[model samples]
Target chain A: MSLASAPPVRARAVLPGFRLTFGTTLLYLTVIVLIPIIALVIEGAGIGPARLWDIVSAPRTRAALRITITAAAVATVINAVYGLLMAWVLVRYRFPGRGLLDALMDIPFALPTAVAGLSLTALYSANGWFGAVLAPMGIQVVYTLGGIILAMSFTSIPFVVRAVQPVLEKLDPALEEAASSLGASGWTTFRRVIFPAIMPAWLGGVTTSFARSLGEFGAVVFIAGNLPFKTEIASLLAYIRLEEYDYEGAAAVALVLMVLALVLLFLSNLVQIRAARYGAVTA
Target chain B: MTRALLIGLAVVTTAIFVVVPLVYIFVQALGAGWSAYAANIMHPLTLHAIWMTTLVAVIVVPVTVAFGIGAAWLLSKFQFRGRGLLITLIELPFSISPIIAGICYLLLYGRQGWLGGFLARHDLDVLFALPGIVMVTMFVTTPFVVREVLPLMQAQGSDQEQAAVTLGASGWQLFRRVTLPNIRWALLYGAVLATARAVGEYGGVAIVSGSIRGKTNTLPLHVELLFNDLNAAGAFAAATVLTMIALVVLVAKTVLEHRR
Candidate 1:
C-alpha cells in the first residue's frame, strides 16, 4: 500500500551521465590497471606451480625475501613508535615551527625516491655528515641492513603519522579528564584510554607502512648496496631478474611481494572498517 | 618538562630523519662551486631527462584528471552493487609495488609479451619508450585524483546536480556549472598530487625505461646514472631540481588544504 502511494523510482531521473561516466571509469581502469596486473598473474601462472615454488624456494630468492621482511618489520616497529609520538606531539603540543614540522612530514611522499636515496646515502656514507660522526662509533649505516631500514622508515613514516594524527586530534578530552579525576596518572590515562582509542588506526597505519616498506625499491637500492642475499630486497631482486631477462624469475619474485602487499592492504582495510563501525557505535 | 622533552625529541628526530636529507641534497649539489652545479644542470643528458620527465607529466596529468573526474563522478554519485569492490580496485595500485607495475606493463608490451608479435610486425615500440613511461606513471598515480575528489563529492552530495537536472540543464552544462565549480579545488589538489608522483616515479619508470641515457631515462633515472657514474655532484645537482619541484608541490598542497 505504501508502494502504491509513493512516487515511482527511476534510477536515471536525477543523473543523466551515469552510463557515460561509469563506462569511461571501467574502460580506463581495465586498460590502465586491471589488465597489466592480470598479465603479471598470467605470466606467473604460466610458469606453473612447481617451477614457481622452485624459483621462490631458491636460496637467493629466499634470502632476499628474508631480508625484505626483516627490514620491513624493523622499519614498521620504528615507525609505529616514532609515528605515534610525532602524531601525539603535533596534535597535543604547540611550539615554534610546529606547523613547519607537520608540513615536513609529507616530504617522503612528495620527494622523488631517487633523490631521497642519493641524499640519505650522502649523509650516511663514511665521509658524509652523519657518517663522519657515526664512523667514529663504528656504526656503519650505508650499504648495510641498517641502511635498508633507514630508507624504509624514511619513505613510510608518514603513513603512521598521518593515519594516527586525525584520530588523536579528534579524541574526546573528557575521557582523559575522567580517568585523571579517578586518580589515574598521565601515563595510565594514555595507556588505558588514549592508546585504546588510537589502537585501530595505529594498527592500520603500521600495516600500510609495512606494506610500503616491503615494496620499497628506489630509495633502498642506492643505500642498500644490493649485495645478493645480504642486502638485496625482494623488489630489487625482481628488478635484477627483469634486467637479466629472466622473466619467469622476475614474475615469481614479484608475485611473492604482490601477495604480501595485497594481504597487508586487506588487513589495513579490515581495521579501517572495524574502526569505522566502532566509531559509529561510540558516536 | 615532559612537554619540552617530547617536543624536543620529535623535533630532533624529524630533523635527522626528514629535514637533514632534504638539506643534504642542496649541500651536496653545491658542494663543488656554483659553476659545477650549473654545468650539471646544463648537461645535455640532464636536459634531455628533464625534457622527458616534463613531457611525460604533460601527457599523464591531463589524462589522469579526466579519468579521475569520470571515476569520482561515478563512484560518488551512484549507489550500486560492487561499489566497494570498484573503489578497492581503483586503489589497488597504491598497495602494489612500482617495480611490479613495471613488470606488469613489460609482460604486456615487451617483445615477448602478449602483443609482442603484433607490435613487432608493425615496428611499433611501446616498451622502453615514452609510451611505456607514461603508461606506468599513469598507473602509479591513478588513485590520487579520485582519492582527493571522491570524499569531497560524496560529502557535497548531488543536491545541486539534481536541481540542475530539474531545470533541464544538459550534462555538460550541469557538470560545468554545478559539479565542476564545486569540485575544482579538490580536483586541482588531486592533479597536483598526481603531478608530483608522475614527475618523481622512479622504480616503475626505471624498469620499463631500460635506463637509456638521454633517450628513455627520466630525471630520477638520470640522477641514478650520474650517481652510478661517480658523479655525485652532478647527481645531487639534478636532485636539487627535483627538490625544488617537491617544494613547490608541498607549498601548493598546503595552500589547497587551507582553501579546502
Candidate 2:
C-alpha cells in the first residue's frame, strides 16, 4: 500500500484507462440526456413561479396523477405476480404450446402502442364480441379506468416475465429438493429457498413494470377516453396542452412528467443493479 | 390439484387476453368481405397513408441502425470518459414517453422553436412536415439498436481486434474482416428490434406528423383515423397487417435464439 510499493495488482489492471473512458461517457451522456432535460426545465421556468405552481397544483393535475399512479401501481402488482407465474411455468415445465405461449408474451413488445390501444378498444367496446358479453354484466371497460388497467397490464406484462425468466432458467432445482428432503413443507421450501433467490428479481421486474406504465401513452390514449380529472393521464394532459397551442402549459406538464419519469428510472435502475448482484451472489 | 389449476389459469389468461384478441382482428377483417377490404385498401387516402408510412420507415430504419452501430462500437471498444453516462443516455428514450419526445423536437424545430425563425427565412418546413415525422421517429427508435448491440459487443472483448491489429491490419479491414463476422447476428437482432420499434412508433410521430388524412399518417395513425371514421373493418385490416409483421418478427427472434 505504500507509495514505494506498486499499487494493488487488481487496481493497476483496471485503473489505467478508466478515467478516459469515464470522461468520454460523461460527455456523451450529458449532451444526450442532460441537455434535453435542462431545456425542459428552462421551458417550465417561463411561467412565473406562482403560475407554474397553480398549473401543476390544479385539482385536475392531482386527479390525473392519482389515476396514473394508482392504475400503474395496481397494474404493476397484477403483472408482478402473474408475470412471475408465467415465467416460472415457461422455465420449469414442459407442455404443449409452451413455445407458442413463450413467444406470445412478447406481443406487447412488438405491437405498436396505438395498435394495441385500438385492438383493446375494439375488443372491449360494447358491440364487440367480448364486450358484448361483459356489457350485459355492466362491466364497462372502454373509456373507463378498467380499460386503462387492461391496456397497461397487457403492455407491462412482458417486462416482468422477461426479467424473471432468465434467472429462473439458471436456477438449480437441487436447492428446492434439498429443502424438501430436510422435511420442509412445499410452502416452507418455496419461501425459504426459492423465494429469497428470486425475490430481488421479482422486485426489479415490478419496478420496471411500474416505471413503464407511468409514461405509457399510446395504449392508454384510446381507452382512456381522455376525460379530464377522470380518465385523462399526465402524458395526455401534456398533449392536450400542446393541441390547445399552450406551448408553455404543455412544457410545464411535460417537465413534471419528465421529472417523475427520471425518478422512476433511477429507482428501477437501483433495483436492477441490486437484483443482478443478488443473482450473482446466489449463483 | 391447485398446481394444475394454476397452470390452467395461466393458459386461459394467455388465450383470452393475447390470442383471442389477435384472432378477432383478422376475423373482423375477413368478415368485412373482399369488396369492402379492396375498397378500403384501394382508396386513395388509404394508399397514400401506406406509402407515407413506408417512406418514413424506409428513412428511419437505416438512420437509426447507423447510429446504433456507431454508438455501440464507440461505447463497446473505447475506454472513453463518460462511458456509463453515454450508455444511460442512449437508453433514456425508453423511459421518456414518445409524446414528450415530439415536444422535445418541437422545441427545437417547431414554428416557434429555437431554429424556427432561421429555417422559416430559408423556407424550410418542419414541425408538421415529413422530415419532422422521420426525425421524431428516429428519436424514439434510436436506442433499440444500441441497447441490443452494446451488451453483446461488451460480452465480446477486444481480443479479436487486438489480434488483427497485431497482424498490421487497417481499422476498416479489422472491422470488416474480423469484428463484423462475429457481430452480424447481434447486429441483425438489433436491427429487427429497431425496425419493429420504428414501425410501431405512434405517439411522437402522431404529434409531429399532424395526422393529416392521407399524407402524414403512418400505419398506427391510419388505423386511428379509420377507427374514428367508423370504418372498423378498415382499421382492423390495417392493424392486422402490422400484427402479422410483429408475428413474423416474433417467430424469427425465437428461431434465432433457439439456434443459438
Candidate 3:
C-alpha cells in the first residue's frame, strides 16, 4: 500500500466506488466541517493581534479562562484517580451487578448534557438530595466552583475509564508474576510493572478528559452560577459574547478554546501512538 | 478483605457518580405524579420539541451513516496522499466544542456572517432555523459513525472485497453483498450513537435554534427552558423522554458490542 503515491494502475480495480466515495467524503467534510472552522479562523484573524489580546486579556475573559482551566484540571484529576480504579476493578474483578456497572459508565456519553446538568444541579442544590446533606456542613455545590468541577467530572469520566480499561485488560499477568517472584510487594508490583504498562493510555485518557471538560458547556452551565468572573467557564463566556452580539469577542475566546482542544487532541493521539508501540513491545 | 474493600469502593463510587443521577431524572420527572408528568409530556411546546428532535434525527442519521460509509470505504480500501490529514479533518469536530461549532456556523450563515449577506440577498434563512440546527448537529455527530466504522474496515481489510471484485461483482453488488454484511453491525452501532447524539445535542442547537417556543425547540432545549423557568417538574418530564432514548441507545450499544 503506497502511502503518498498515486493509486497503482491496475488492469482491473480491485474495489469499486473510489472516485465516488472519495468525492462525497471530501465534499461533505469541506462543507460541513472545514469551511465553518475556516470561517472561525478567518473571523479570529480579522481581529488584529492588539485587539485580540485586548479581548483575551480583559478581566472577564481571563477569569472565565482561569475558571475553565482550573475546574477542568480538578475534574481531570478526579477522573484520573477514579477512572483508574474503575478500570482496574472492572477488568480484574467479578462481582454481582458488574455488567450493569460497566454499562452505566457510559451514561454520561449517552445522556444529553443538558439533562446531565439539570440532574446534577438538582442533586446538589441546597434542598436537593446530596446537596441537602452537604448544605449544613457549608459545602455548597451548586452555583459554586465545586459544582463546575462535579459537572465536568461527571461528563468526562467515561473517557478515562474507557481509555484505560482495554489497556488494563490486555496487560500480561506474567509481568506482575515476575515482579512478585522478585520479592516485590503487591503495591510495588503495581507501581513498577502494572503502572508503567497502563501509563500511556491513562495519560491519553486524562488529557482527552481535560480537553472535554474545558469545553463542557451544557453540563457546566446549569450548575455554574455563571457569575461573570466567579464560576463562568470560557465556553459560556463565548456564548455570552455571542448573545451580546460581540461576535469578535466570541470568536477570539472560541479560537483560544479551539486551539487548546486541538493541541490536547494532538497530544492524545501522540500518546495513543506511543501506547500502541508500548503494547506491541509487551505483547 | 482487601479484595472486598476494593470492590466495595468501586461499586459505591460508580453508584454515586453514575447510577444515582440516572435514577434521579426519573424520580424528579415523576415527582409531580404520573398525571402531571403525562401532562408535561403532552404540553404543546414539549410535543413540538419532541417532533423537531425526531425530525432532525430522522434526517441526520441516514445522511451521516451514508457519509460514514463513504469515508470509511475510501480510507480503508485506498491509500493515498494526505490520508492522515483527511482522517484528522474527519475527526476535527470531536475535539472542538459544540458551542464553538455553533459559532462557526453562525459566522458562516448568520445575518452578519460571511455568507449572511449573500443568503439574505437570496432570501435564504439558514441561521436561527432548522437548517442551522441541522448543520450544527451534523457537525457534532459526524465523527461518530466514521470513527466507529473506519477501524473495523481497516482491520477487516479489502481482501473479501477483492475476491468479490474478481467474481465479477458490480460495485453496488459487491458492497451490498460483502461489505454491507461485514459492516452492518458496526454501521448500525454508529447509527445508534449518532441518533443518541443528534437527539440529545444541546449547545450547538441552542445557539442556532433561537429557542422559539413551539417552532425550534428540541427536547433538550425545551428541558433547559423549563429548568430556567423554575419548572423543575416540567424540565425533568421532558428530560425523561431524552433519558429513555439514551437508555435505548445504551441497550443497542451493548448488543452491538457483543455482536461486533
Taken over the whole model, the C-alpha lDDT of each candidate is 0.91, 0.77, 0.90
lDDT of 2 by residue, B30-101 (tens): 786888877767778777877887788898888767667667666666553454556667778877888888
Report, for all candidates in order, the number of backbone clashes.
0, 15, 0
Ranking by lDDT: 1, 3, 2
Ten-residue segment with the worst summed lDDT in candidate 3 chain B? B78-87
Over 4 Å off in model 1, which ranges? A1-11, A280-283
> Which parts of model 2 have CA positions greater than 4 angstroms off?
A1-37, A278-283
Instruction: Write candidate 1's Cα lDDT for B143-258 as tens digits.
Output: 99988888778778788888888999999999999999999999999999999999999999999989898799999999999999999999999999999999999999999999
CAPRI level of candidate 2: acceptable
The reply for model 3, stretches above 4 Å from the true place, is A1-12, A278-281
lDDT of 2 at B11: 98
lDDT of 2 by residue, A1-283 (tens): 0011111122223212344444544554454445645666677776778888888888987788789888898889889888988998888778888888999999898888877888888889998888999998989999988888888898887988988787777778888888999999988987888877877677778877887888788889888898998899988888888888888878877877787777877787776666655553244
User: Model 3: per-residue lDDT, tens digit, A1-283?
Assistant: 1121123223235678889998999998999999999999999999989999999999999999999999999999999999999998899988898898899899999999999999999999988899999999989999999999999999998999998898788788888888999999989988888998889879988998999999899989899989999999999999999999999999999999999998998798777766665562254
Report how far off residue B194 is in candidate 2 (Å).
0.7
Task: Report the error of model 2 at residue A268, Å.
Answer: 1.3
Worst 10 residues of 1 chain B by lDDT: B77-86
Cα deviation at A101, candidate 2, in Å, is 0.3
